[model samples]
Target: MTKKNLLLTILATSVIAVFAIIALMPFFFLFISSFKAGSEMIRNGLQFKFDFQNYNLANYALIKTERDGIYLKWYLNSIIIMIIQVGAGLFFSSLVGYGLAKYKFRGRNIIFILVLMVMMVPVEILILPLYKEINSFKMIDTYAGVVLPFIVPATGIFFFRQFCSGLPTEIMESGRIDGCSEFGIFFKLMMPIMLPAYGAMTILLAMGSWNSMVWPMIVLRTSEMQTLPIGLQSLLTPYGNNYDLLLSGAVMSVIPIMIIFLLNQKTFIAGMSAGSVKG
Candidate 1:
């Protein structure tokens, strides 16, 4: 490569690295802030002395009517909602994607395009009408009301389809010749091969479900039903900021995701190969 091109590449890499750091700065600050006294965090600069007593779980007590926290309820609610939607999302999408990839059908292109078209539409456009429909069905403020609408995604189908398309047809044909039923072949053989794709899919679905806000906020009316994002929003006072409590809340919201990712790391990396390089 020419010196000019090399210089440009270096410059681009440097700029991207800088931007990545800038984006992550808030999270780094938030983690550290949770460990400091509220007064010291605001009044002093970034470097505050560590004090375990200062960082007591009392910050989380703001949400509790009792000992632990009402935040715990929100956390549980979020987990339940996430479990339902992501499970449904992955299951339905994978079924459809597998069919599309493996079978030849009339109007296949039409259906695929229709699914892709959904990606073009902004979610906000559907909100008002969706809310009205939910209300009409008397589903508002319920767990089903919050999770049902979000239980499917065009992208999940697309990802599964892409991954399945890359799979060799010889395997399927071999399974058929061996007198393997379609369900048996799919579940026993194909599913095992699709682990990497499922891993990536799980990560995407879980993170999105965990962080989902606007729709949940719209559907969940009562404090009892609020999820983590909604609960954190409620923590923001009408008065100025409560730094320690805010930091603690942020940590509570973030730590679970980190732990989940860490625990499932091998699978997550395997999943990252979903639509990419084959084994």
Candidate 2:
């Protein structure tokens, strides 16, 4: 490569590195602050200065012994809900998307348009009606209530539709010629080819479900049923805040998302690139 191109590449890399560091700064502050006592943290606030005297494992230890380890219960609840949301989201959303992408049927364009319209409408606008529906079904404070409304996300459907549109339809025709059922073709043939899409969607769906607060808070009435975000927010009240458990728990809550992103990092980029260009 020419020196001009090389210089440009270096400059671009430097800029990206700076932005990445800026993005990570909050998590860095949260990690270090979790080691300090509540009073010290409030007094000192988030700072670059590292004082060994102010730091301890007390916050983390409190997570284990405090309130009979209710923090762990919250963590488990979030995990279960995330799992259900991601699995169901992928299954139903992809089915709808694949049908729209590959099938020639009436009202297909109208259905896709409807999906886009729903995507444009913010979730906040639907919350009231969703809550009422959940209440009517007597699913309040249950996992179903938390996971049902958003199981087939409009965004997921749009994404999968775009990706599947670029796929060759010959394979699908071949499956039919082999006497495979429609479900068999989708599950066995198309699904394997859609792995990159699945990987990308898995991370997206997991993050959405894990970080969800408002919906779960509305649906769950009991403390034991609360997800991590709700549980952490509960630490803050009009009287005082429990920074001790709050900071440490928040830091730990980030672990699962980081692990998921790392695992799917390769497929994520590919899937995103292909989807962007395809449709």
Candidate 3:
């Protein structure tokens, strides 16, 4: 390669590496801190220096014994919520997006415009009404209350719609010629072709659901039903802090999202970029 091109490549790589490290620094700190005692953390604060002598698996072990292993319950709850939200989100959001993109019907543009408008509104602003609505339906303190309200997120709909718009409709027509039902065409034919989009959305939806704290916090009343984030935050009280449990639990909470992203990293870039371009 030319020296100029090589130099540019090196510069870009160096910049990206720096940014990646910057992003990962917090996680690294959290991982290391998890091994420390609560007193040590409070005394020392977060430090760059790793004293191997102070590190131990005690904090992790405490997770199993603390409050009769309540941490595990929180983890399980988060997993359940994440799966439901991601699965239902993708299914319903993609179907709506697909219909909006592929079908020429009355008020289609208006509906798509409304989706865009919803995307602009912050969830915080709608929380009051959402809570009231969920409460009215007697879904409060239930998983349904948390998951149902956002099962088909506007962001997901917008993403899937944009991606579907870029796809060719020829395959859809061919499916009709072969006497395939509309759902069959979408599920059997178009779905496979949209694998990249699915992969990308899967990671995005998983992360959002996994990390969600506010809506779940409001909906879930019982301690056992509380999600990972809420459970982790409960460690910090005005009386004292349980950094031993909190730090370790925080580290564990990140695992699911990291796994999802790693599994879908290959298609994430392609899916995100492809959705922006029109066919």
Candidate 4:
């Protein structure tokens, strides 16, 4: 290869390597801090050390037994909420998006416009109204309150709509000719076709729902109903701090998201690229 091209290749590789380190630095610190004793962490401030003797599984163990295993309870709550939210969100949001994209119905354009408008409005702004509505239904401090409001996310609807818009209507027409019911066609045919879209949305929605703190903080009044993020924050007390448990719990909290991304990495990338091109 020409020297100019070789130089550019080396430069690009170096830049990427540097940015990768920058991105991973926080995680490295988190892992390292998780291993350090609270006293050592306070003294060293997130530094790497080879003090294996000082590092123990005590923090993790304490987290497990603390307050009747509340950490595990919170983790399970997050997992359950994420599963239900993603399942319901994907089905309802995609169904709405599909109809908006492909069907000719009265008020469809207006509904799509409303979805777009909702997307533009910040969630923080709607929190008050949503909380009031949930309270009116006597759903406060309940899982339903947490999951229901976000089950049909505007962004998910918009994304699926854009993705579905690029899909061929011929498929649907063919299904109709084959005597397939519309719901059957959607579930059997369209869902498989939109797998990549589902993958992308799954990761996004999973991450958001798993890490969601604000809305949950406002809605869930009981400690047992709390998710991981809020549970982690509750580790800190006015009288004393539980840095070791907090740090170790923080490290563990990242595992589910990493697993989700790794599972859907290829499909997620393809979906994102396809969505961008189609959009």
Model 3 deviation from the true structure expressed as Cα RMSD, one decimal place:
3.0
Candidate 1 achieves a global lDDT of 0.78
lDDT agreement with native, every candidate: 0.78, 0.89, 0.87, 0.85
What RMSD, rounded to one decimal, does every model reach? 5.1, 3.2, 3.0, 3.5
Q: TM-score for every candidate vs. truth?
A: 0.80, 0.90, 0.91, 0.87
lDDT of 4 by residue, 1-279 (tens): 699999999999999999999999998887866776665667667654466676667777867777788888899989999989988988888999988998989999999999999899888998999999999999999999999888889999999999999887877888899999999889987887788888998899999999999999999899899999998887765335477778889999999989998998787566433322231
Overall local distance difference test of candidate 3: 0.87
Q: Which residue pairs collide in model 4, if any?
A: none
Weakest ten-residue segment in model 1 by summed lDDT: 270-279
Superposed model 1: Cα runs more than 4 Å off: 1-24, 36-68, 240-243, 271-279
Better model by TM-score: candidate 2 vs candidate 4:
2
Candidate 3 per-residue lDDT over residues 129-225, each given as its tens digit: 9999999999998888999989888998999899899888888888899999999989988887777888989998999999888888888999899
Rate residue 10 of model 1 by lDDT: 96
How well is each residue in 120-204 modelled by candidate 2, as lDDT tens digits?
9988898999999999999999999999999789999999999899787877888999999998989988887888888999998
* TM-score, prediction 1: 0.80
Best by lDDT: 2
